[model samples]
Target: MKGRFVTFEGIDGAGKSTHIGWYIERLRARGIDVVQTREPGGSALAEALRELLLAQRMPIETELLLMFAARRDHLERLIRPALAAGQWVICDRFTDSTYAYQGAGRGAPGERIAWLEAWVHGDLQPDRTYLFDLAPQLAAQRRAAVRTPDRFEREDTAFFERVRHGYQDRARADPSRFVVLDGEQAVSTLRVLLEEDIVTLCNT
Candidate 1:
């Protein structure tokens, strides 16, 4: 059987990360081979780029280019091979993040982002993307409670609001590929919903 690509997406502190491990365990219980990873940093070169991305403050164009550059390396070095080996791949973030963070949050041109996305990995897309939706102010509070903020995470609420809307718009445009979840929901509740979705995905 061919492997499925699953990705978790959301703005900082939207609680998507908390569910990935549990979701992987659930897949394992059913005997599925799974490879869990995250974007901006998956392969060695990608990881090095990730550090620069998270720390440096650069032009939106540079940031956008670097994002796709890391993605290309990640795909060539890790994501592609794992999927070819029939391992289900779960990534923390994907190109949708670029559309949200750079295209929307930073007011970068959408067409340019689309162009880069096509050039880098037009053939691949996550089979399912779980988007955790939340208000920017609430997400900001949650983020403040956690570890130090990264460059993107340090942006103001207005920026995050744009990012959130960007994610929602994409989800609306591609309903078949996105599953938007309320970030404020209880963990147990979200897991129950995710369990049903995963089972359905696995059976398909």
Candidate 2:
């Protein structure tokens, strides 16, 4: 059987970071062979792009292109291979982030992102995408004390508002593949829901 591809997404501080480890631990305990990776930093080349993407300012088009470039490398070098070998690939973020951050947050055209997705990724899509939904104001407040904000993190509240909207739109359009989870809920509660969902997914 081809392994499952699961990607977790959300705005900067929407509690995804807090729960991912716990989720992965449970997945591993269930005897799933898991490969935990992250976007823009999965492979060596992608990590380089991740650094540039987070530190440099460029045109929205440029930023979006670089993101796809890294993704191509990540998919080819790591993600595809792992899944082909029957190991579940759990990614921290993926193309959805590009749509939210570059397409919506930066005002890049939807057509442009669509074009790139087709050309770069073919028909590949996540088996499941969990969105940790939270308000931008609350998310920003959670991360206020973090040291040395990255480019995306440094963006003002309005930018994140657009990003949050972009993610919500994605969830609405693909309800079957996208799971929208309220980020304000207690981690324990969310974990239970996540585990139940994953159990169902794996059984299927």
Candidate 3:
């Protein structure tokens, strides 16, 4: 059987990262083989690109290209192989992030992103995507309480608002593939809900 591709998405500090490890543990407890990874990462080359992408300030078009370049390397080196081995691949973020961050936040043309998406990994989408939806202000507050902000994380509230709307738009366009979660919910409550969703996905 082919393994499922699952992704977690949200604006920075939306709390999606908090559940990733727990979700992986849950799958392991059920005897499922799994590979946990994140975008602009998951492979050595991609990781190198990740550091540059996170810390360096560059043109929007350059940033978008680098993002997809990292993704292409990640898919070829890790994601595709893991799935072929029947191991579930749980990624922290995916192309939807590009649509949100680069396309919406940076005002890059949607068509450019779409073209890159097709070129990088055509028709290869996550079987399930969990989007933690939160208001920009709340997310910003959460971010401030955490570690120092990175390049993308340092964006103002307006940028995050655009990104948040971008995520919502993607979810609306593909409701069947996205599970929109409320980021403000209690961690325990969110875990219970996520557990149920994981169970259903595993069974399917």
Candidate 4:
């Protein structure tokens, strides 16, 4: 049986991590066997790469490559296996990040990134993607309150604005598979929306 793969994506400080647990709990309460993981940091090697990528000083190209490298390891080691075993895999981020961060944010060749994704994982795409939509300035404020900003998070507002648009573009292009959620709302409100989506996904 093919298991469900759901990915959560958005610009940094979009409150995705803050809301992840709510979804996890809702799924487990319904007796679903869920495997929760985050990209660029799922497995040991991937986690190491995540640290390097998030550090304050790394070339943009290096960051992009590291993200992909972690993704390759994450898919082969954890994601695919969990899905094959009929587990619901909920990932924090996935290929979409590469497109937004590298392709749109850092101005990498879009075709090259597309080629890389296909080359690395032929048919491994998320069944559903939930994109938390919010302005970069608001997101930055939220980010500032929680923890120190990472390399990506430290980018100027203009850069983050581009990243937000990148996400929006991806979602718009694939509306059938992507759901945009208003991320500026209260966490309680977001939880309700997520629960609704979860019910629809599981029941279908």
Question: How much lDDT does candidate 4 score?
Answer: 0.88
lDDT of 2 by residue, 1-204 (tens): 669999999999998778778888988998988999998789999999999999998988788889999999999999999999998999999999988999889999998999999998867899999999999888888898665678899999999999999999999999999999999998889998999998889888
Pairs clashing in candidate 4?
A: none
Best-matching candidate per lDDT = 3
Selected candidate, larger TM-score, 1 vs 2: 1
The clash count for each model shown is 0, 0, 0, 0
Inter-residue clash pairs, candidate 1? none
Using all chains and alpha carbons, the TM-scores for the candidates as numbered come to 0.98, 0.97, 0.98, 0.96
Worst 10 residues of 2 by lDDT: 140-149
Q: Model 4, residue 98: displacement in angstroms?
A: 0.9
Off by over 4 Å in 4: none
TM-score of candidate 2 against the unseen true structure: 0.97
* Residue 118 displacement (Å), model 4: 0.5
- State each model's C-alpha RMSD to the native: 0.7, 0.9, 0.7, 1.2
Output the worst ten-in-a-row residue range by lDDT, candidate 3.
Answer: 195-204
Q: How many backbone clashes does candidate 2 have?
A: 0
Question: Cα lDDT of model 1 overall?
Answer: 0.94
lDDT per residue for candidate 4 within 79-186, as digits (tens), equals 999999999999998999889988899998888888888888878889899999999989989888889877788899999888899999999999988989999888
